[model samples]
Target: MADDASFPAGSEILLLEDDLPLRKRLAAHLRLHGAEVTEALRLEEARRLLRDLRFDFAVVDLHLPDGEVLDLLREGAFSENTGVVVMTAFGGVKQAVEAMRLGAGDYLTKPFEPDQLGVAFSRCRWNRRATRRDEHRSAEPGAGAEELFFGQSLAAVRTQLDTIIAAERRLERRLPPVLIEGETGTGKSALARWLHQNGPRADRPFVSVNCAALPDTLAESELFGHERGAFTDAKRARIGLFEAADGGTLFLDEIASLSPGTQAKVLTAIEEGTIRRLGGTREVQVDARVVTASNRPLDDLVAQGSFREDLYHRLNLLRVVLAPLRDRGTDILPLAHHLLARIAARHRLRGLTITRDGEARLLAQTWRGNVRELAHEIERAVIFSPGPELDFATLGGAPIPSAGNWRNPAWRLPESGFSLETAVNEFIADALRETGNNVSAAARRLGVTREFLRYRLSGAKEPSAPPDANHPGG
Candidate 1:
């Protein structure tokens, strides 16, 4: 009887419908069920109420006189606690999919039951409440603080951040698990933490596990815990990361490396919210939000049979792809500055500023290591810079020409002043001539990947002017 719950007591609901009679009946039903109801007849009125109050629930009619209600989901007008239930008389499966993708918690057709309205909010609140309770029972204590952050950069990077922020605003019932894909050192783990901190369960614990770092022999026990004497080394009963993170978030970084056995077990926990400790008899239920990050393509891995398709489906509900630093356009210098300041503060050194030349060098180069590499460079620069200003040398390595110069030969500049990529390509071509087109000797002489050189030679983009402070991006 208790499991067949109706709604959370005193839950604040925003009900928007053009049909006044139907809206009133829905409001009356919700009010009678002990929910605080706010009614709006027009989209504009709903927009106004959303701006002023934080509601626990939102029941929106899809077609309004002004426009479709999908805009509200796109704009994130409602708070994160609001589980948007889109009701429509005209729309079908396509509309429902669109609503779900845009962050609706539930979708309903016209002539649906008031009790079915109750059903829409059930899984989310129940899981959320259960998670909260689990947090109280966690054996390991949680840190009471959370870090807050917002990121900005040039156009490409800016677009990426905007997409991430939009996804963060969605208040789905179960808080759809996120799959973050990016190159190594591109801040995949950092982005995962940001999502957890900004989400509805922010106040709860955030547990991070580096799947790649865990050894195959012990990863299962480490993740799912082990009862005393469950394995050769099990001396006492233990709690797994999932239980520790109940009611909060579990960030699995480098998740693509998880072995098949571990992957299967993790999928079970995600799908059923339950896990059995290694050597334990009973299954323990957990309610931790899952966020996974991978440096490689999980799809390719799945196709290769290295990963489970079912697990990938469960984890890839919402996606955030972090761009490599080199592709981020004009955001390079601003990020460098931010990193420099933080690095200086952390090291107890005087704040350091990047010189103009330093900025140019920073903007240039293939940052194969991405943001993490950049941070290390900044830290190194801080350690050696005598004055408050940092030069290119302090950042380490000679200033390399950007990919732009190689990709485009028409961009005008002094003879040798701006010919890094062009010069490198020319030298390689000349080497081929000098060696009579011997690719093996060319590769050996150049000490570079033959594939790498070939890619550059064939895949160069249209030439563009050097990056200017006025125009920045990857």
Candidate 2:
């Protein structure tokens, strides 16, 4: 398995291609990039390789002699973490869409260059690797669901929540689909869980799905049941999440990440109160209340055509927006103490308190990760504390940007307003300088993708800042 933070290096790869020339070229390219390549010319050979060797990733040509390469995906031939990418000479929208629905991590058209292959490989390489176990461990029902501590800023939202509760009481059979929008780590999941525990369906089932972490393949069938023979490897008719959460609530977190196909199915299910198993024709009515949460704006996504407008409207029927921790001014210290008490109790400590310096640090710091980050920091402090008091000195710190250029520290405004593009260029240059001209390290600091950084660099005017071994990630 690959590390939590690096690319797929020294990982075993299974390459299946009927075109011998293409297969040989791709295998060599992968090996050159630090992969152990296992080549296969036919479906049978690929099956034998899959059976015999453990692989980190599989590159398969959709048009295999024995059958569709999708069969290998369906047959449970690859481990859960072993990502797969599909390639085809006869590429079309239908094929690509089908590949996505079938759970391939990425897709590529034929006659592509080694660079294109690497792009596809990269997609499957750094894909989010959180499993259901990690989900359960991270989202443990922290504190009680009944207790909600909100500052004065949340008065309006509190009223909205009360309205939801009232509506839930009146609507005996079904509830309106609720949507919660907030930044990451702003307690969206916790709020969703709270609603499930407090609502009329308190005794019923509650299913939570992290949309960002869902595998690309089998997403639709997983949400809306699937029949036995829905595809190659679905041996038994399985109840989808909707069915599993029947007469209860289904919470979908980071809902913006859902694909267009999955989004359509979800919209249909919500509007019609019916779900058809992937291969089955019969429509089964489900009484599950969908409460989706997104860290991004769904309206923007809808306008951009990435998200369906109908789905967005449906989800917005009952919407709640959560304020980020930074904006929740008075709640900072109290929230810190609340978390500290829980951590101390769990660790069997007599008493724990945050010192004055710790409180100031919490208030002054820009919590990029929000409440989730605070919780983790508090836990670390409790575990490693030599004594009871938690001091800010023990926690590490980073450089703070000046006030005038908080977002862009090194850039300054001249007497004449500078162009926005020029400002961005200078910011990139400053980042490179700070990191000593290392683009990857600078990208990490900038919180942008390497591709984004490189695009910025490439777009710069004449005298292009050439980046190679000397300026990495540039």
Best by lDDT: 2
Which 10-residue window of candidate 2 scores lowest in summed lDDT? 407-416
The digit string of per-residue lDDT tens for model 2 on 362-458 reads: 7666677888898888898888878888876655443354534444222234323447887678888978997898888888666666777878888
The candidate that wins on TM-score is: 2
**Which pairs clash inside model 2?**
103-217
Task: List TM-scores for all candidates, in order.
Answer: 0.53, 0.54
Q: lDDT values of the candidates?
A: 0.71, 0.73
Clashes of 1: 7
lDDT of 1 at 408: 22
- Residue-level lDDT tens digits of model 1 in 1-474: 112346766777889999988898889899999888988878888889987775667999888888878888788775543578888785575887698787777788888888788877765454434443354336345423333222443244445545655665684334557798889988777777766666676677778777887889888876787655678876544567776676678888888888998999999988888888787656766677888999988888899999999999887766777767776655677788878777777788775688867876676557889887988887877877788888767445445445345332212333224448777788789768867977656655555555544655687652454323332111
Clashing pairs in 1: 131-247, 328-474, 329-473, 329-474, 330-472, 330-473, 408-463
